[model samples]
Target: MKKIGIIGGMSWQSTQTYYKAINEGVNDHLGGLHSAELLMYSVDFAPIEQLQHNHQWPQLANKLSHAAQSLERAGADCIVIATNTMHKVADVMQENISIPIIHIADAVAVKLKQKGIDTVGLLGTAFTMEQDFYRQRLQDKHGIKVLIPDAPHRTCIHEVIYKELCHGHVYPDSHLAFMRIINELHFSGAQGIILGCTEIGLLVSQSDTDIALFDTTFIHAQAAVEFALS
Candidate 1:
């Protein structure tokens, strides 16, 4: 198996999920005692979060690029930025490293295409939802239509992700709120829902929604495992 490098700990909460999912996926594929060959460089989310709020993407990119370089130096065969929002700097990280940075959106897009899902409802950090980096990639590259919650709902979703989910605080009210938002999107013609934030899977799952739900954390990790084993 190839060594899979991860730049994680944006919150440490979702990084845990990535680690679990990747190992579990490898074990399920290869059977008993088999697991992923992994290397991880976890960052403190405080500084990164501040940089994002300040709109200092250059500095943020530098920080993530440095992390990717460290993983490459440690002999990682490929890289996974464990958070969906952090993928804003994926190109910068890839430019600074030799190994591949498997993108979360691209992984999710492939699944959507395979399932014939043309339009998807996206829930993530404000940047991931509002920015062109993610939505444009899916629309332009894969011919997928991406829809996001409206202004009010988007604010609620973003706040819940940072203030609650990222810190591992999952409340019953939050679950209800998310379901309401998902239902609204479903009515708005969203064929499926993309849990674009890594921590979101903790709050909502396929069982909670009637429409198809795509957990980016699982898709990203599964893609990494496939690349590693190939």
Candidate 2:
């Protein structure tokens, strides 16, 4: 199997999910005792989060680019940024390193197209939602229409991700709030919802809504396994 390099620990909470899901996917595919061949360079989220909130993306890009270089030097076949929001620097990371950065948005987009989902409501960090890096990739590359919550609801979703989910806290009120946003997106002509943040799947699932929900964490992890094995 090809080695999968993970750029992780943006929170460590959802990085744990990526590790689990990727290993589980590999095991399910290959059976007993088989698991993923992976390398991880986990970062401290405090500094990263500070950079994100401060809009210091150039520094963040440099930091992650160095991480990708380290993984490549250590023989990782390809890199996966474990967080969705960090993918804003994916191109930078790829340019600075030899191995491919298996993108979360592209992985999600493939599934979206396969499922014939034309329009999707996106829930993520404010940067991922408001910024063009992610939404534009979907719309321009895959012809998928992207919708995000309004300013207020976007704030609530962003807060829940950073304040609660990143800390491994899941609250009922937060769950209710997300559900309401998903419903609103559905009524607003969203064919499905993209749980664009990795930590979001911890609070909500397809079981919680009839509207199709795309959990990017698992989708990206599964894509990593496919890339590794192929």
- lDDT string for model 1 (47-101, tens) is 9999999989999999999999999999999999999998898988788988899
- In Å, residue 134's CA in model 2 sits off its true spot by 0.3
TM, every model: 0.99, 0.99
Model 2 per-residue lDDT tens digits across residues 124-189: 999999999999999999999999999999999999999999999999999999999999999999
Where's the lowest-lDDT run of ten residues in candidate 1?
A: 89-98
Which regions of candidate 2 are displaced past 4 Å? none
> What range of 10 consecutive residues in model 2 has the weakest lDDT sum?
92-101
- How does candidate 2 fare on TM-score? 0.99
State the local distance difference test value for candidate 1: 0.93
